[model samples]
Target: MNDFKSLKPISVYSTKQAVDDGYLIQVDQKISQEAGIRYPVYLTRAVWDKYVEVPEGMEGHQDQSGRLWDVLFMFAFFGRKETSSHLLFKLRVHLPNTDNWEHNEKVAERSNRLLREVTLKALVTAQDFDDPSPAIFIMKPFED
Candidate 1:
């Protein structure tokens, strides 16, 4: 058998460090609890900037809390159907015209906004290398 115990990591990145470094944004515990998520939840900076944060022109149309709720709610709904450590779920977001055309072009003519469906990945794992408490980390599908 391989001697795994002899191997040593070059460096370690903890969840708490990630949050402090701005790489991970911790979701409000209360909001997550309201969505039926029992554990702590976090979002990658990319996910936060793209999906959760409302664009400058979309101030009246959407808010951060509502967008965050949509993400958590959808995850909770899909999470109940599967028994896996990782989950890929869909989120429909109303995006403002910010010159990012990679998303769906389906639009609501009245508002001139594009409704795009994005897939995000959620990972359930220990809070840190030494901490076994469960936590959920949300990020773009391609993110590590």
Candidate 2:
């Protein structure tokens, strides 16, 4: 085998750096704990803005905390069925119907809000390659 130890990485991005740079938002400890997650959990910023952030004009109907809770709870619920470090789960959420379906009568019949299913990927791993502390990261299906 090639000498892997001789190779040096040109750049490195740790989980802590991602959190500090706002690329990853840490889920509240209390919420994760209540959701039966014993490890620290984080949601990629893209995931947060897309699903967890309540859209404009939806202030009273939904809040960030509740949205986040749904995500964590659903992950926990599905995670219990598997023992893998990586998990793929689907969460059903209500979001403003911004799709243009005027041509499709079937879709147009839906109300202003639509219940949508979104796929999220969760990885349970160490805080960093060198750190053994367990942690979790939830992100969109394609995100790293």
Candidate 3:
């Protein structure tokens, strides 16, 4: 059984800094304090830019052997909600534990597939995103 241990609520919003500086992933403040990690953690360039956005001049964008077509691909894949309840969970679980993200293409591909499957299932089971006791759990008290 593919038992997901817990879910992490993710809020992806646009900020001038994010657009200019690159993608940012900020774990909820309270959760970070509890987890003993930094708050408003900025995604490392190596981690965040593993995939680049497709330029306009480019004829088409394809998932290369060792590249992703930017994080927007992820948003599109996950149904583009303002609040994604288990995004961090899906990312942490699906992403392979490799120092080099590109080293294991097969593993990365598999992880992506699994994350999608689990996220979809959770969304379906939850039915309403605003339900107090949604099937997918939030990682922080602030989120409630």
Q: Which is the winner by lDDT between candidate 1 and candidate 3?
A: 1
By lDDT, the best candidate is 1
Write out the backbone clash pairs for model 3.
none
Q: Which stretches of candidate 2 lie over 4 Å from their true place?
A: 1-3, 100-113
Model number with the top TM-score: 1
Off by over 4 Å in 3: 1-14, 21-44, 53-70, 80-86, 89-144
Residue 122 of model 1 has an lDDT of 94
What RMSD does each model have against the real structure? 2.6, 4.2, 15.6
Show the colliding residue pairs in model 1.
none
lDDT of 2 by residue, 15-89 (tens): 889899999999889889999999999999988987799877788999988989999999999999989999998
Candidate 1 on 38-111: residue-level lDDT in tens?
A: 99999999989988999788899889999999999999999989799999988788886667855423344545
Candidates' TM-scores? 0.88, 0.85, 0.24
TM-score of 3: 0.24
What lDDT is reached at residue 121 by model 2? Answer: 92
